[model samples]
Target: MQLKNKKVLVTGAEGFIGSHLVERLVELGAEVTAFTLYNSFNSWGWLDTLDEKYKKHMEVFTGDARDENSVRKAVEDKDIVFHLAALIAIPYSYYAPASYVDTNVKGTLNVLQACRDFMIEKMIHTSTSEVYGTAKYVPIDEEHPLQGQSPYSASKIAADMMAESYYRSFKTPVAIMRPFNTYGPRQSARAVIPTIISQILSGAKEIQLGSLLPTRDFNYVKDTVEGFIQVAENDKTIGTIMNIGTGKEISIGHLTEKIIGLIGRDVKISCQEERLRPEKSEVNRLCACNKKVSEITNWKPKYTLDEGLKETIDWIEKNIHYFKSDIYNV
Candidate 1:
């Protein structure tokens, strides 16, 4: 299960985490294919900014993951597939739930079918902490009940179930990698970390945010990517779901204050009504139990919250122009 000289296909490779994964895979000596959403601009999303040294080794295939034909073409001849393509914005999902189902659930089905047909060695399916909703208990484990509070989480739950069924029915070498809140460079402004950092760096005295009471277990992007690699290399991970996260939790209000302190800025926190999720849809708390991943693989979170926030702040400061802090990004 060594990745060296192996062929790997990463769907959504143009995204925040996917681009980083592609870079790491190249560094690991794997032949990489990046499946990006097609556009007339021919944009590779964040991958377009990757250094040539890493980008040169990656083959970019621009296609929609929702299309079975496109997914099959990308899966062909690949030893492993990392499925990450999806519509992830929670607010946007509320407005367009069908799109989320089409992209998240159906898109995943396309990839799973392609992997099954191609007989790929491994397919790492991405899951989210949102599926757990508001935790019924502290330090949620893989077996914790999945409550889809929002359309986005519901779609992901369906996708995860699809992967599980494929593994059981067809013996597809599928491993579900559930990552908690992952934050770092190239993350969209829709996410809380980027939203906070972008606003502060944009010279806003007031930060607009959703619920401040919700607690989340945040993991740095590098740590999450390593978790993916660890799952792929371990044959024992097949047909299992593993959680990747720092076992620590932070409230959004505390996280905002920490970011402000790191940037050495004084800011006012404003909870905008528009930014808030519906009462039932909002996941109030999430804490990961990394016991499964730690006991089974070498994956462990390396960066503390302060450390990761500092890095994210630095990146957002330098790329401040990329964000429109005045507008709430859906």
Candidate 2:
């Protein structure tokens, strides 16, 4: 559990959650190799925002997660691997479902294989509450049935099962952490929270969104990062899945109104047909049960909804140019 001096590999180190996790790992004193998706622009995504001093400690390697050779190279001498790379946008998945399968499922298989081959200490695979589909029951626990409401969620479900197989068949010391809706600064515009905030911050009087009645259990990015670390530290989490959430639900309509109030705006809410997910594909509700995670690891959420929203608003206002507020992101 002592992270100091340990070498860690973090796939998707350039993403919203992955970037935050990398920062935390650096603070924990872990020697980090950050696996970023290769791009001609040579951008590091949110990792570019990290302090120069912290960036010095992380070695960045850019390559595709689905590339077995690339993933194999990233795994070398790593004591732990946190695999977070995936095609996460549900709307895009309808157009490019194959990419999700290749990255979310096959990419995870590569990580598991390399971990076993290199004898890594553990592998933490990131899952999502979307795998639970529309919540059949409020406060979904680990025992709740998983129903993939979209191709994107289905791919993630496949990846979660793939990680479990590695633990059972190869004893690869894998843990699955399913996070509910995590939102914060540097989040992509494809996500609902960021989309609304970016538009409102850009001085829009009306916000376009999908279904407002769908409720979600939201977790702040920092709190979700802590949950990942706790799972990595606790031995009991091995071969098991844990939920990270605030244990409260908010309808998208209410959330938008709350943000409007926080930003001191009287924005009209508009439901865009193009923005809505397919009737069956839409997850109408999601509320997580975190009792199991709390029992196994000393982890708890630190941010309330209002507090997190304020922070998100501040970030979006400062970086309004980074967002295309006039267009629907996905």
Q: Model 2: how far is 69 from its true place, Å?
A: 0.3
Distance (Å) between predicted and true CA of 329, model 2?
Answer: 0.5
Over 4 Å off, model 2: none
On residues 1-330, what C-alpha lDDT tens digit does candidate 2 reach at each position? 877788999999999999999999999999999999999999999999999878999999999999999999999889999999998999999999999999999999999999999999989999999999988887899999999889999999999999999999989999999999999988989999999999888888889999999999989999999999999988889999999998999999999999889999878999999999999999999999999999889688999999998999998888888899999998
Worst 10 residues of 2 by lDDT: 1-10
Task: Please provide TM-scores, in order, for all candidate models, with all chains considered together.
Answer: 0.99, 0.99
